[model samples]
Target: MAFDFDLFVIGGGSGGVRAARTAAATGAKVAVAEESRMGGTCVIRGCVPKKLMVFASEFGAEAALARDYGWSAEPGEFDWKRFQTHLKGELDRLEEVYRSLLKQSDVTIHDSRARVTGPQEVALADGTTVTAKTILVATGGRPVRPDIACSDLGIVSDDIFGLKTLPKSILIIGGGYIACEFACILNGLGVEVTQYYRGAQILRGFDDEARGLVAEAMRERGINLHLGTNIVEMARAEDRWEGPVPTASDAAMSQALKGAASPLARREGGAHRPGEAGPIWVKGTNGQQDVYDQVLFATGRTPNTEGMGLQDVGVKVNRRGAIEVDAYSQTAVPSIYAIGDVTDRIQLTPVAIREGMAFTETVFKNNPTAPDHELVASAVFTQPELGTVGMTEEQAREQEPVEIYCTSFRPMRSAFAGRPDRVLMKLIVSQASQKVLGCQIVAPGAGEMIQLAGIAVKMGATKEDFDRTVAVHPTISEELVTMKTPMRTA
Candidate 1:
């Protein structure tokens, strides 16, 4: 059968865009379809903007710490609307860059939603169809909102970016990274914040010490930590009382200046309205309908497998609707493949991008592609933040004979700032081979630290190597290089 292109990607996210460009650069015809912005979640809503806001919000906390830093400046107010305007402008500029990449590579960029009509053909939202030798579903995952979260208010990571202003007092639900980051962003921005996690702590999958420090730092910041709490039900100011779950409710989520939470709950849902995003009432595990200005379900994500025509082509999806892809990112149907959050395998943006590029190289250029999923670094932008890679002390003990070395101490700067935040560091080393099994950190710039160690852990660094590395005086980072004793031996 004659094909219009060598590769046709169904989503224009990190994975799809990379795959498209890489394949085209290798002289294969490529086309990509996207219903939303060019940069996908990272640039558009998730990482880029989120990190920017994190920096912006940090200014407030730093303002307080400035006095300790021997620099004094009066506290200033934050303009969420203006900040958002700037963020959107920057994002639009980045989108243009992505567009330029596709043009430069001569890859067709179709700004429309796409679905698999069969193994070879993909139908765009505009009813245009394209045929290809291989179809890639880099379709990213969608935010999973709780069954009942808010009525006319509340927000998700996707919706938070478009908010007109920040909430004065925010009640963030779930202990996931998103919830923790939002909590940090808001609290750092001078919002009286509270975080509710059904689990005992935030960043559930992280090491025990990192989780402990993050949780402790969060509590120290007056962001009322509500752990192990269940949702009861939700209520609206106008609506009458009801049973466990209420049908009519309003949810308002605000970030700054303009406050909009589920229908006027905290500090009145004034200026900071949802813009186009509204809130709904949510029933909590407490058996009481809790009404908050902003409610976030950072619980998890579901794949955007619907309306993709994948089912018709026999592309197998898990019960959760995630595309069932193997380590090589191949779907059940050989002609079709999937990557990124769509497959739900270690849902990191970098992972998805790598998988996409690898798939392109292996199939088109005859280059072997298989990524070592181990020793990949990840950071949760919580107050102090948590970064981790490779195995946890718990995970490594089961298989590899290992020794666990860890330390928890107030970061030097925090000691000066009078903030009671502790930086926790740990390394898991295999006793048999003397190779580093894992590395973790709970501190500011943890993302940077973890990535540096990721290379070492991946290359089989030993405890002796870490010990031999010279410590850079008294810095948060020195904790990783200077740990002298083992916390536990297997």
Candidate 2:
């Protein structure tokens, strides 16, 4: 007899695992395939490990501050090698926990990659296949590498978490949320970090005021900001591009194909690669590339859909390799669906988990519901941290008349801590109805605190509702409640 199941989830990421487990709970047989560990990207590469590193880096600054707080100790150094090992141990434990949970729930764990072989059938990387009543793609996305001349010079978010040692310096090459957070994490830890954005500003999709202010704060922190500039061109040409060693032959070929310069520059103050411990050359846009021990890439994520036979089943994908799905996560091939980063809608971990849950209720339980995505609040665990919910002041003004109220001030703690970093909060309200159109927060723990506002904003809270709430005294969050006059409310 051929074994069959009610649901088969491809890509054992947060969304896929969640959907599988939830479906299994409904007395449906479920099978989940994963080429990597369980726990998905958030657990393995994206958020969890990145945050662990962020927390580790913050201690470097906090140790110095502890003296000001009257606590003193013999200053030690950070061991990047051991930290990586510990992080790996933690991730392994978490992955085991996820696998155990799935097993206890009796969900079949296929230890391989899965692809949509047909409408309701999936082919595993091992060549065997599974046929189910429905298929779910939760493959998630991965970091994208650039096409610079120094192929060895580039790195991505995926490669940073497993770093054996903390870098002395880094150049992050994106303006998106990922790059911004990494710049914060790296710079806060005392690494000389530089950010390169193609536009005149960073955080392109965010509000204008918020974007401008964050850039200022980043600059204040000594983050080398190169705005309105792309990598222009990078090469191993030592004389032109800066580097410590000679260019690898393949690197030279790549540069030649791109028409980049060929004068490989000499090293500055002498540098060596850690592993091979050899002189390696790299070129940067400044025409002055220093020999650094490491490079952390923070560009963007590509949905993990390659080689995962999605199109074989007639599944639709956008130009960016993100799976195409309707509001209910339904694909053109009705029986096969996708959620989370694979769908490329809202690529947050919590959003993926929610979409997974919603999918199970709608399909297996027959509830037929859609995941709520409006006013979804998210945070970036940067040095000051950032939290945001609802629309932005700019986004609100496009539709109708909006009122904008923005405030920038140092929080009370900053006075004592003497940190130049300030808190920024903004609110967008509709002129006709006084409804809160958007909310943006830039401060410590902004991401953690924004969840409360997220609920209210999703429920269609108005600016009046914000006013109704009494201000909590001596707190940074209270600024949201105490907006006096509008800067520009549409």
- Most lDDT-accurate candidate: 1
- Per-residue alpha-carbon lDDT of model 2 for 88-118, expressed as tens digits? 8999999998999899889999989776777
lDDT of each: 0.77, 0.77
Q: Could you report the Cα RMSD, in angstroms, for every candidate shown?
A: 5.3, 5.0
**Could you tell me how far off, in angstroms, the CA of residue 446 lies in candidate 2 after the best superposition?**
0.7
RMSD of 1: 5.3
Error of 2 at 315 (Å): 1.6
Error of 1 at 195 (Å): 2.0
